[model samples]
Target: MSADRETLEVYNARAGDYAQTMGRDPAAMASLRAFVARLPKGGRVLDLGCGPGSWARAMLEMGFEVEATDASDAMVAEASKVEGLAVRKAVFEDIDDVARFDGIWANFSLLHAPRAAMPDHLARLYRALKPGGVLHVGLKEGTGERRDRLGRFYTYYTVAELTGLLADLDMVTDDLREGADKGLDGEVAGWFTLTARKIVPDTEARTDTA
Candidate 1:
């Protein structure tokens, strides 16, 4: 399934508020820098679920081709205001590219999808990346699915669970970070970031008898 209707409405109505709360942070940009460092200069990157286009704008400034997309009309409108950034209206399920992008930044976005749909969404993302391409995923560190006090739906996951899911899709988990922070909801929560790579053809078919 896609994003929940109430969640979309909340985002539509409070887009500006959310942007204000999520304004660019130097530490966050450091994470982005690390992500881009793994990618070649001028590589094409997809900012899946880009909110307010901050990261997309940063990547554009860093000289990479970026496709910034989100499902919310308000978000797309906000992201389009940035000059030279190609923003589009798209949901996670709308992604259907095959080995097209050198990297995908799915930070804090796919957590909105239902837990049952995560495997398919992850597989689609795997196919969307070039072999050996990098993928960055940020998710709330927890269990099960529920709605926040702000009326937004969330699907949480443990690090091990997500690691297994990525393994099933032949993506190698290489980097991880975890911490707690207060969100727009005024509540401190745990979250984790995972950086993985799509397995290349030879690695996919290799047999390890050791």
Candidate 2:
């Protein structure tokens, strides 16, 4: 099976437990809160790969118009339970909108995409943003792909590698950090955190054209 499908199956089977286990650290939440604070007031934001919707809820409480999405139906169901949150079912490639969102919180989700498709996916994300929009994505730092003990697939990216992948995109770094994953599952997880702003073009190009 493809990595996306395989990972979806695993997540569907464990969505409830996974949702329950997804608790954010106070420090991380505080940082995210500050990040969102920088956006235009009541901005439209997309919570890409919004597992269980905690961030969506937090963003809603902070007064942003939030759209949350995930590929796993179970995950979508879990996230939809958050009343008033707009939820959808979609994979990474399903994102093809142009100038739609002011911000996108990818969290630890985009790691499921295949390495070969990373650039195209990043470009789609770039096109999906409004002028001067910001983006935040996280990934485990490594080379190539692997399956976790839970049977979920992950495509890792080194800091330099990720930097290279993003270099050609129309964005500038806000923050990129190398660190440990806070060991949520009892093991050290190498991680790379990225925050960036989509550069506003003088004249927008046709990003999606025949």
Query: Roughly what TM-score does model 2 have, to 2 decimal places?
Result: 0.89
Q: Which parts of model 2 have CA positions greater than 4 angstroms off? A: 1-3, 182-186, 203-210
All models: lDDT? 0.87, 0.80
Instruction: Estimate the Cα RMSD of every predicted model relative to the unseen true structure.
Output: 3.6, 4.4
Clashes of 1: 0
- TM-score of every candidate: 0.93, 0.89
What tens-digit string does per-residue lDDT give for candidate 1 at 1-210? 246788888888988987787745444566688899999889999999898888898899999999988988898888898888888888888899999999999988999999999999999999999987999998999998999999889999999999999999878996688887788788888988888998778656564322
- Evaluated against the true structure, the overall lDDT of model 2 is 0.80
| Candidate 2 lDDT, 1-210, residue by residue in tens | 123777888878888888776764554565477569668999999999998898899899989999988998988999999988999998888898999999988888878888888888889888998988888887888888888876677898887777676678847865665666544345678887777788766565455331
Q: Identify the candidate with maximal TM-score.
A: 1
Clashing pairs in 2: none
Q: Residue 25 error for model 2, in Å?
A: 2.8
